[model samples]
Target: MSKSLNTLFAALLLSSAGNVLAASSVDLTVKGLITPSACEPTLSNGGVVDIGKISAKDLNADQETHLPSQYLQLGVTCDAATLMALEATDNREGSNFADDMAHFGLGLTNDSEKLGGMELRIVDPIADGVSPWIIGLQNGSSTWIRSYYFARDNILSVANTGGAIPIPVQQFTSSLRINPIIAPTSGLTLNNEVAIDGSVTLTVIYL
Candidate 1:
C-alpha cells in the first residue's frame, strides 16, 4: 500500500458558480480513464448462506459462541486480462460493536441491543500463476503496505508494484471464509428470539 498504490487513483471535483462571471466564455472539461477490461465479483451462494436456527441453549452462558466456519468461493471475472482489485464495503457499518475492523456487527435487537459481528477472510487466492497481494491503503492515507492475508480492512490488489498488473488470465478465484458469532449470553439482553442480520457489498475496482 505504498503511495504509488494509494495515489494510483483519485477523483476530481469541479465547481462553478458565483454569478457565472457575467456569462463570459468558460471551459470546464471532464476526463477519466475508461479501460477495455471490466471485472465483476460474486459469491458462490449468490451472497447468501443459511446458518439454520440457533436456540438459546446452543449458546454458552458464560462466553460468546462461534457457530461454525463456513467457506464459500469468491471469484472475480474480467472481460479480459485487467489490472484490478476487489473492494469490500460493510453494509452494516458500526452495528457490530466489535473493535476488529475485519469484523462487522449483526444489527440490533428489539431493545436496540448489539447482537454481535462476523468476520471475513480471504484464504488461498489463485490466479493463473501470479500471487496477488492484499492491501490496506491505511484508510486511504499516503502510507500503506500489501497484505497476503486479508481482513475487512484491506483491499485485494493485483500486487502490481508501481502500476496496474495486466492479469495473466481473465479469472481469479479465492475462498471466502465467513465466521459469525453470537455474543455471550450473559452480555446480551436476549429474552426472546432474535434474528442475526449481517451483510457486505463487494465491488471490483479497476486500477
Candidate 2:
C-alpha cells in the first residue's frame, strides 16, 4: 500500500521496469484529523514541474533522464504560532532510482509498467524568532531549537527528523527542492502515450 496527497493525474513515463504487469486502475485515499491550531501549509505551483514536451528519441537509451532540478517552496503560517512537526507520507512507496527511502516511488510506468523515483530536499529554513522549539514526543514538552538547511534532522519522515522542536512563531518558511529521476528508455516499450504520476503529502503532527 502507498500514499498520495492527491492521486497523480499523469506519470512521467510509462514502461515496465521489466515485465511486471500494471493494474487497470488504482484508488487514492487520504486520512487525517483537522485541528483548530490555525496553521496552513502550501506549495508553490501546486507542486508540479512542467518538463515540457520531451521526445522519446531525444531521451537516452543507455542512461536515465535526470531532468534539470525543479524547485518549489513549502511554507506554513499560523494565526498564532503553534507547536507542530511536519512529516512526509509517500503515496507511492518503495519506488525509486534506488532503494532510498528518502526518495519516493513514481508509481507504475503504464499498464503495470514501472516508473522511476524522486526525492524532496529541505533547504533555506527561515522561522520566526523564538520559533523551532524542537519537536519531541508529545509527552515531553520541547524548547526552542533551530536547524539550518539540509540538516538530517529536517528530512521529513513518519518518525523523528524532518520536524524540529516547535518554536512559538506564527510563520515558518523553507525551500522544497524536488529531484525527479526518469529511468533509461532503452529497455522500456514506448507506446503512443506516457504519464508521470507521482504524489506525496506533507502533513503536520501537533506535538
Task: Identify the candidate with maximal TM-score.
Answer: 1
lDDT of 1 by residue, 51-117 (tens): 8788888787777789898888988888888767677777877768565776777887777777788
Question: Alpha carbon lDDT of residue 115, candidate 1?
Answer: 79
For candidate 1, the per-residue lDDT at 76 reads 85
Question: Lowest summed lDDT over 10 consecutive residues: which window, candidate 2?
Answer: 150-159
Listed in order, each prediction's TM-score against the native is 0.74, 0.61
For model 2, how does the per-residue alpha-carbon lDDT over 35-111 read when each residue is reduced to its tens digit? 66777888999877776666778667888777676788988788876756676667776555455545676676565
- CA lDDT of each candidate? 0.71, 0.60
Query: Highest lDDT: which candidate?
Result: 1
Clashes of 2: 23
Backbone collision tally, model 1: 2
